[model samples]
Target: MDSNKRRHVGHRRDNTVLPLAAGVAVVAASCLTLFVKALLKRNSKPTQKQGKGREGGSAPKSPGAGAYVRGMREREYVRLIPDVEMLSLQSLLRRIQKARGWQFRDDAARDQAWARVLATAQSAAGGAWPLDFTPNDVTPEQLQALCDAVEAEFLGGLLAEQVRRAGRPRIRVVLGVDPRDPYSWLSGLHEDNTIFVNSNRWREEVSQDNPLVFEGALCRSKLEALAHTLGHELTHAVVLNFFPAMDASSPAYTPDDKHGPVFMWLNRRLFGHVGHASKRLFNT
Candidate 1:
């Protein structure tokens, strides 16, 4: 009986050690991460801090979604469904950021700045680049929410309303990190109505260019970037009645047509900005 008790205690100790060891590993990892972060900050340029927290869900009543989700709807808009957690989102972000050297900051200001890098880049391309900071913590669900809000609020009055209502040809935005390719801004899977936005490329472009306009304007800029991208994609998703139909020999319409003159004219009339569709459309 005494021998049996001794063996059981040893087994219990063995089980306890695994959790304890795992806990220790997590703590050590966190400490190391913090240390590295501090070292980087110390060596980096002197940047201002932004301590503001993100506001409520994607509600029209909620304040500026970095001016991305704006324009008065006939009635109040509410999101009935709560955001859902992405599948292994952390692991995915980690891999993308790791490969691209995308640095993150706990300092609200710094994180906000980092997040807005994409917005600044989009703005530098010029479309009244509004001063708004969009956060980096956008979940897949929130992204969808923003899209839905944009569709409802901005595109509702446009000719695209019919396409928006049918909803069969859906549009999707996903976060992908590919270091080897520069097709990072936005790629469309038209067959299935999907758009892939490369997070890695965005980070690389913004970080390298560093078009950060203001000290505390991270979230605003981030949302502006997303809003512009959403608008660009929405244009692709829906065909305006005015859109010239593709034909056998009328001069092959290149993918660049989406950001071409006609599209920009319609874009300005509809949602206010032509976005960074192309260099030619930048100032116009």
Candidate 2:
């Protein structure tokens, strides 16, 4: 993207506080505290009766016993911790508010929030998900491979043109595992082009066919979550590399400014949301 497309017009008055940013900060802090507890809960052994439904009722019986069993298992694994899900919704709202300068007093007033997000994502992808954007199912051992696949697929396609247009050499990003951070599932360093993904904070088991829903958005699965994460970090790399003027290192940049319009647009296309999933929960 060019400077005109990436740059934001109008400025905030000096020392003015943004409520959306404050909201995000509050949610981030809460997520940090709850994330630790979530990790502990994930690591603890589960009881035999843990396979119940979302409301703690018995699993539904069906004529197709195999399908019923699979559905139960998927339901068991395809969720984030409750607090994490709530925080993710808050984070998504903050991002929407930041991007559109929208304010919502209640859920009724925010009816168009997700529609706006999807519109932007679709617009970014020329009215649909990118042709090369194929998110696959993932197992615990396949996270790194999934990352590699996303990087290869994206860079091998339109993203490569952006790099070439900037007169940059071929781009390669390093992927690392972060087991220590309980709050963030993924983070990146644009300077070194390194992306770190965390698994310790996720549930012990993941479902291949089920999607984790946050707010009204879908992660598709653990594979899709990690893929979207790579897309998110890679957006940072692309923005920081090609659009130096939008670099987050500057002291003057706001939290929203760090993930600028291009970042939002690209990620929205990649993941169908302007935000990333940072944790997972097992249905308990």
Candidate 3:
């Protein structure tokens, strides 16, 4: 009996040790990845080339999505929830700061800036904003909640008309992370009427561009980036009439052709330019 008990204890230790070792490996790998990314950013120079797909300016090609359907409801302009005419990241931040008399100082002002983001999110979400220190910590469920709030508050008005005309529910926003592609800002929409937001990419971008911001403050930048990506994908969903898989199979299709002038115009009109869509859109 004592021998059997000893054996059981040994097995428990083995299982515990395995998990601990795996956790260590994961931490070490994450550290290495951050170090390498920092080194690359430090050494790299900004390129002015357009349409070449650079970080912060372009999205990866859509998965399982055929070429863009040309001239298909591209001219249709839908109503927006926000009353503002032009929406840019800077403008959004500025409006919030102005309301509270907050000024951007050096890195020390990060908390003040972050407060504005939370205020805006809480207001827009009607006090249902999920608070987390980092995007890495936020679960997919929390993200979906955020998306639901944004859709309900900012884009809810369009949903009724969309359903009325199309006889189906509005396009659903699904949150997912693609840690493998660290360079992408946002993975383009898929054929499943779901929008994938790269939380991993968002973390990398925030760490690289806003080093001073950390902890909960980091979430401010993440939310802004999320806003941009959500608007872009939502435009695609609406334009495709909430059914991307079917619409994309049309014979007249070309990769990235969905980003033509008409799309940009409609995006601007519907949600305003929040983040860079491509090299052509540039940083807004």
RMSD of each: 23.9, 28.6, 27.9
Where model 1 places Cα greater than 4 Å from the true spot, the runs are 1-137, 157-161, 164-167, 177-189, 204-220, 240-257, 280-284
Better of 2 and 3 by lDDT: 3
Worst 10 residues of 3 by lDDT: 77-86
Considering every candidate listed, which one attains the maximal lDDT? 3
lDDT of 1 by residue, 105-219 (tens): 2244334433443344334232323334222544566555556555544444332344456555556666664333435344332434556666543442222134422211221
Report the alpha-carbon TM-score of model 1 versus the true structure. 0.38
Q: TM-score for each prediction?
A: 0.38, 0.37, 0.43
- Give the C-alpha lDDT of model 1: 0.41
Residue 36, candidate 1: Cα error in Å is: 90
lDDT of 3 by residue, 175-260 (tens): 45644444454656665456676555554433234432221122234555564456566666655764344246422222344664
After superposition of all CA atoms, the RMSD between model 1 and the true structure is 23.9
Per residue, candidate 2 scores C-alpha lDDT tens digits across 134-190 of 223223334344444554444333445556687764445333445345345444544
Candidate 2's C-alpha runs over 4 A off are 1-145, 151-156, 160-183, 208-210, 214-217, 249-257, 260-262, 275-284
Better of 1 and 3 by lDDT: 3
